[model samples]
Target: MAKNPESPNPSLSESPGPSSSSARSNGAPASAADPRSARSAAAPGGGQALSPGASSKHTLSARKGQFLISPRRVPGMQAMGLQPLALNVIEDTLRSSPDIEVIDTVGPKNIIGVLADGMSESPGVLVARMTDQKATVLHQQAQGRLIVERDHPLTLGDSMPLQPMMVSWSAPTSGQSLDISVTVLGRDDAPVADAAVYLFGSMIPATGTTDARGQVNLSLFGETPQTIRGLYVKPKTDYWSFYQTDPDIRTDEPNVVGLRPLADWPALANFPQNQVYGWGQKAMRLDQLPNQYRGQGVRIAIIDSGAATSHEDLKKIRFGFDVINKKTNPDGWSDDTVSHGSHCAGIICGSDNAFGVRGFAPDAEVHACKLFPGGQFSQLIDALEYCIEKQIDVVNLSLGGAAPSEALEQQILRAKRAGIACIVAAGNSSGEVQYPASSPNVLAVAAIGRLGEFPQDSYHAQTLTQMVDANGFFSPKFTCFGPQIAVCAPGVAITSSVPGNNFAAWDGTSMATPHVTGLAALTLAHHPDFQNAFKARGPERVDRLFQIIKASSHPINLGDPSRTGFGLPDVLIAVGLQAPMGMPSGLIQRAFSGAAQPQMMSAQPGQSMMGMQTMSAGFAGPYGGFLPPYLGNLQQGLPYGYGFGRPGW
Candidate 1:
């Protein structure tokens, strides 16, 4: 086997070594004014530790309206009643630090802070908090320079405690079921699947998906539901609403049932308490989704950092490999110290339990291919190749980089030719969309901020439906922009399982990509025949399946260029179950234009699905269901940290 160069960190494995500076330094005179002088002076009895009279000798510099002082003298100001203004002072200092190598930042609270990787020269001093004006005055009295101008008024209102939004939920109601059957219409009354029809009563009683008909039956239950006489149902986030019409009531007939601007149910009266932004009840539309994906034979490959198979929510991660650490066990990949992989993985295929947020395809199998955390182009290629060899039907690449990789693009093309659906994140950096998401065969997804039905702002409120095109897609706040974005979904305030079976709210394109992957898995579940095409002697069937997915997408013209892509993705479209007139005519022409050609698209042409072959291309079938149960439970599977490598290689 060919050997790859080894470049693991030696500090974790080897002993100390002499510094080059020490070895090269000849007998040079040490200067008293050097910045390093403070360290030597502070050394235990090494020199004069600030003499009493000289202790107050400090200089203050002024730039614009801001005052700069030695961080060491900051404490005396605190007792004078002054407080820090910004949420993060540590971050500001590091950006201006002269001799420190900053790594990452973490704030204990909402206040700002900066983290540096190499700042041992000044240990406690590296972390600094600003003292308010009152504290500044107190410190000035203690001989430290008060940098404030005498003419400038000190604002006491600069400091205030941060109060994060808190939401609590009343116990859910049981027994009473609010059965709702919905009929969704598009250009000409065309039915749309996964349109997420939610019936939010006091609390959600029961949820079900729509069949071939765009009808969803919600079994409503909650303590508050019993108290409220009239119930109203509305599309969760976008501009849409639905209600049940009762013809028998002659007293005061409300003409519109299932229409926008619902008058009967006070919008604010029945709104649910806030949960974590995305993982909470309001964040997910699955409960409103039909259970059509249930029992489907679909396998989704989570190609990110790595999986925490041991997580209670994701214990069912049957098989996974570490491309970064090159390890076999799932444990080493989840180091909270430096990682976003585990969080991304937990969102994609987390276990569906009470403890954490449930995944879109909770039952689908997750083949974790660690390629993001300690990113390398080669690792990503290895993961793609592995998925192709294993025949993974749906490959979700949640992580992305700026410059496109031709090698990675080639692998995605291979996966597409092999009948493997590729789902990539639309890059997090908002302005430019990244590849393979930019690849034609891949489905690129964007993020959306979460909101409840209760109106916070009149213009912002009133039944916001998950529309085909909206600000939900090209979240200007995040990265990854350009025309490649295929669809948009909720990405903000998402709560998922983390390491140690705990849960926290997170955001990123990584979270958005999985929603599309799960939807693609649902497509496979409904059309088991798509997988069969890869098993046949030719690629014609697989090609047809791709055509089907293209055909099913709902074309949206929301008047916004940045937010809307190809509109929203529908499982029925990908499976050839539903065809809408709004689909791009050009795409349709290309798909059928070459229908006469025998397998115009093929992954290495000769490779055929001859018999009952094993689930090679990331297909997890012979096992009965598409995903493992642990991947479904939101409670147990979230990995804690996103670190690569174990104690040893």
Candidate 2:
């Protein structure tokens, strides 16, 4: 690629030119010194190169694909042409690094193919075993070779304790000696002769020594029970017991064996959680919901920062557009101008894997549409337009600026016109509910603490003074409060996959936004008919689904209009699939009688506050041993109603 002199010095995506203030806010230093100028002396052609003495104490790193090679210089070589010396230095350093093994040089191939040695800590090792993507080692100790694969079950902590091979077995007999044979093979598949063997059966002694053919025979005597078991020929250490055995009388079942802990079978958290960002073994239990709508065919567009498409969790991502760079880097580069985009992607459709965490709709495909790194109104508009052009079903916008732009608002309206569901985050500034969300068309999500705690309105500073923390009942210190917020979910301590196959936890309305996006995917999956119906009815299908979601929320009146928009969104209710449970008829009658405003009700009622509605039968009333209390300041205000005007006795 020859240089385009007229092009901007730094390769930034096409965009409305940034204002002077915007550049300053992005931390651009005002200094005009060209650091590369000093390098000319080191090159034969007067090309730029830094002298060893001139090297600054701080060395900036350069990343190419998965490789993270630091600053260094190498003598020019004909083998690599006259490429930057830094690239060769990094390659050489990686070759010697214990944790990395260069499978091949990409320069000659024009295509790079490399794998991470998860078993080692090489400075240049790129792939990680427990990250969003998983790396499988071809041999033990992760030393032989590595392969980056998509199977989620084979993760860092997964191990096969026993190797497949043949071992002899003998049932116990009364007053008769029991004999058994066993063999252990090496990588060559050849037997290791003279190995020790231990035979164990119910009420029988186990002992043995192997012959030259790698065969071992064990004899035991006792009122041998029908059940029998066996163990390896040799023990690794005297302190650690070498043999294991189990006795099951049934001929069809194999005997059970137990190994004593020589060392704790290392905990999953200990196995480089930093790589997968410690997404625990458990993923979001979508099966636990009312329906398991496998999102096999749905495409959800994540319009934010670029995604780590190569991430083990997101191997199925489809690149939509690079509104910023104009060029496509589908593997989502770690050099994300903003991190919010990636975080939102993880929450919506993060790959379900053994080593890392899972997403609500793990099977749904992703379309990475990078728009705003730090909230550009125009970029948001561009991304919305891009999603509409692509016909993406779900568009997740996790970034929001000061206010909604008319252009941005109209784009959202247009998306709804085209049957796209837009999920926008309630801004984190604790400021007023911003655009898109406030536009009444977007599903505006607010941040809620682990136990439904939301920040009190910061605007009412004088009123906030009267509130005091008790039982840790106070709202999250930073959660934004507003009427624009539709629902809330676990926004704090949200862990997701990050670049470099690592994990990080972040909190914001940004975190809450993905839950809604994921739920929408599931909704679409279950009700594909709804989508078809939309095609028949045109854009109104967008609001129809929105109405379904709004009608299904766990309503709570927080007194303050700016806090919870429609109450907490109930996914099951939104999708019309709540399970049936028992309820009291008298309670239901009283609830409706107490209501003055026209009420939309479910077919039944239950003691739960989720997934069921009814003017007659089943109503959620605190089933599952816990009842939702009256919503916010409403409990203190109107004695007859909880919050949101839900009738009370």
Candidate 3:
């Protein structure tokens, strides 16, 4: 009998063994004892026979209340466009049979058939009718090449008994209890209270719940140091959820885990003043450079949920399309029902007006491609095709799925072949980079946060002091990490425009992706050759762009290269400008060493004491003095000397 490709019932293996530490101490065997050992011993050759009246030698039996039909694939039918025809024959034959009702199709090849209650005493008659109909169709259209068979009844002996297994790891002890602290954070970068965190691998596994500060402390009672095999967050009714970490965490420094909420934004706060030049812009040194190229003539498309077309800051939106609704004109379809698309668009090209926040590439014309409503694989393909047809320079895809789909991958490759550069989020799952981003042709961006920076604050001071030995600036707890990461950017507590002409701070690798997209536009606008290569769809265009971005990035000293990639990108270096002196080097170490600080003369020297005081206060804390030269000297302040209030985005 042919098995269904999609519904194969592979035998289950025994559960895993217990933690290594527990197994060693208790002298337990490595494998779990088989629960079916007794039955196998009694049965001859471990082969059991079916009960009487259940089945016959020639035909398989069905359950007393239901009938099963298994459709056999016709070789070469798919190539001839006859696969749909086979399905139609099955449906029509089942519908025409007396008291026969088709329930559903199952399996990858659509081979399984479920029927409702009818002829409960005998299903052989129904099965024979289905077989005859299938044979007749094949004879008429396919020269009787195809076949159909009745599905066999599932017997008790067909499946193995499930055995429980436990995971274990070895731990060496020092005869001292280890104190460990853990902080759980939400995707928004806020503390998650009351969520349970479990610690396993030791003889006595410890567990605790996070408090108001989203922190939990654990004390291991083992005699010496031991490995922890697993650390997981127990599922709860709240908004927080967690993913298991690999190479289990040791009982050393406090661990920080980020949990994603059901919704991106749980609440909103009022927009603050001093909104221009957000930390993201400052980190890339956009404030100090000349505004000769703000992506003036670049064409970029943000393919996400949708964008707020009428928002004051998003007036530069020149074109819009709804891939989900299949609409060309903006009416009703192009509006951002979910604020994620609007936020990403704002980061890329929010208007440069004085009233609201400025975007990275303020003059770039952004096109909104809505795809979130019916985010099917086909819809994503259509969106990519649209980008190719329109010759879009840059496509900001701040969305992705956990599993890679071949159809989606083919579309991304098609876009690459047509010279469209895609910037994708590495996901917020804190694991492997998600699909599309994981695709080599696309640029995958990881998220980073300033050390000790809080989400509510307007400006995340660039305190590289703590990150001196580290590879990147911010190692956001939630951002996914892997070798596919192309670059790192500010993705934590990032403030951008929402749907209602309002501004809010959001966090995710989604937010980080647009920073690269906006910078790519600036790079292309400044270098005409790169733009020409992009338009010509040169094979080396994407590779060359990746090389340029990496070449311009500042080194982040992370233990895992997969996490930070080539560190953070500097717009100055990317656009052919001289490298800045204060690009997150050893400034913080020098400050703590009592070294002479760099000075800058203010327009009014005496009027700068307040700025100096603010800088001093920021440096005096535990996360002190790592500010770069541009932001270090508070006396010079913002372009207009806008006090020490949090710098805006």
Candidate 4:
């Protein structure tokens, strides 16, 4: 590996541009030549006890913010109150104390914060600055708040709470303890381990993941035995998340719950493993695209769990990094244990090798940044910095979170300034768009399904809504909605590569996002407007890319703009071409020989003779299903501390 990110990696097809800085361990100072390294430096004015390596784990619990204190915002300003914040006062205070590092100026006396504790004096020293300067800090007992100016306000809240740092945590020392033993079973009474079991009563559910014997032990504290109001079982893979309401149960013995299998309902049904591509490729018209426009010269990144380099279709991907393990992990970004990233990668860049599924931009350069299975906000910032340093053109964020982070917002803005277009998933919670996606700087995408594109017996039918347009396209019931959605794409029954060289069909807004990202890559690499915009690398290039996508989109009658934004962005329209006149052209595929190859456009709904895959009640794979809706890392982050709410499988 090169010591400097700027030095060419022998494996990369094209050398990365002169980066602003090299990626280093958390908070280490950068060479004077590269200033972008300042994005995450946690060096407080005076050195103290904590070392960057020493504080690495603890830093995951850090926080930051800058509040505006003006006359109108101050207490009793008209009568006899203290004056508002001034630049000189803030600077002097920041200079005199070793707790805060001044980031940038919003206005006089109003300094905007960038990231983690700047002062390395101690573990929480840098974040404590928020308390001293403007923000009100809180600890384990209650959720914290850090005032932020909303770029685009929504009806969700009057204030967006600062995700707590979770500096320290411990369970209640004294309380009425209750324990429940449960067993999870799959189709045919097979054991289901790693399945999350939540027992909902009058209080928040007591949660636990089942062990290999399909057993889980859950304990909660209260006054006495709590009534079993509901039992929800969520398996990690290939099973429908199960929910049961009010039933007879005894805490004395094992409680059993059964889950529906995600696929192979009729046994040996031909999934994408036998097909050339998934339905998404056809809906985005990727199947009909010119063979030559395979996202050549475009560099893309998947900032999710990780990509399986060993996956046959993903052999061409040569670059990746483990953000959570930058100082360690030994190039393990390619070891995708979660399989979510691999699936998304296959959708974006899988090879058209004729044996497995095809990707939208099979030839584009892909760099996977491992940030999930376990990742924090600070780690997310580092990943985007790596993107900027690597000059990545398109970023696919299949993850999401409920709370917004100012540091993340700044880092994303920095990437945009460097001309990177970030396309994110509108969540699958059937709620409003999640953060990052909700940020105005990035493009947010929702999920859409064609009426007959997937099997009716499959769970993909569960997502089918009454909002189907005249063209048979409809907004999926599980996709998050609101004004933030930039576009919609095929997210139901999306078949792509998983780990172990096998392929699986799945669904989610996570699947929908990559379609747009893959299309963005094609436009950037081949569009004339994009070619010209690259001349002067700035925010304008990003703006142009976004404009072309929206302007080229063909509207759908999904009823609400919040659900599908401008609608599905056409590949030809996006790359400065036109949709064929008169009637929709049959899939115009072409081999390397450049010969026209017409193919089936789509499947008719309810037309199949028989036997498909999966139970008719839910979605495809784990987290990929619409019922449980991959909750991202929300449960892990709790009161807002760590892990992106990845809307992924």
Q: Which candidate comes out best when scored by lDDT?
A: 4
Q: Which consecutive 10 residues in model 1 have the weakest lDDT in total?
A: 640-649
Worst 10 residues of 4 by lDDT: 154-163
Better of 1 and 3 by TM-score: 3
Q: For residues 140-226, could you state the per-residue lDDT of candidate 1 as single tens digits?
A: 442322122111111100001111123123455345443445454433454444444433333323344444555565444442333
Residue by residue across 65-155, what tens digits does model 2's lDDT show? Answer: 2211121111111222422224355456445533343432211111111111111111111221121111122112222111121111100
Q: Model 1, stretches more than 4 Å misplaced? A: 1-285, 288-292, 327-339, 453-476, 528-547, 555-557, 571-649
Supply the TM-score for candidate 3.
Answer: 0.50
**Span of ten consecutive residues with least summed lDDT in model 2:** 151-160
Cα deviation of 444, candidate 1, in Å: 1.9
RMSD of 3: 22.4
Over 4 Å off, model 4: 1-269, 272-275, 401-407, 450-465, 500-507, 532-536, 580-649
Q: How far in Å is the alpha carbon of 133 misplaced in model 4?
A: 6.8
lDDT of 4 by residue, 265-286 (tens): 3332443344475667777787
lDDT of 1 at 402: 41
**Error of model 4, residue 193, in angstroms:** 4.9
Which of candidates 2 and 3 reaches a greater lDDT? 3
- What is the lDDT for 173 in model 2? 50
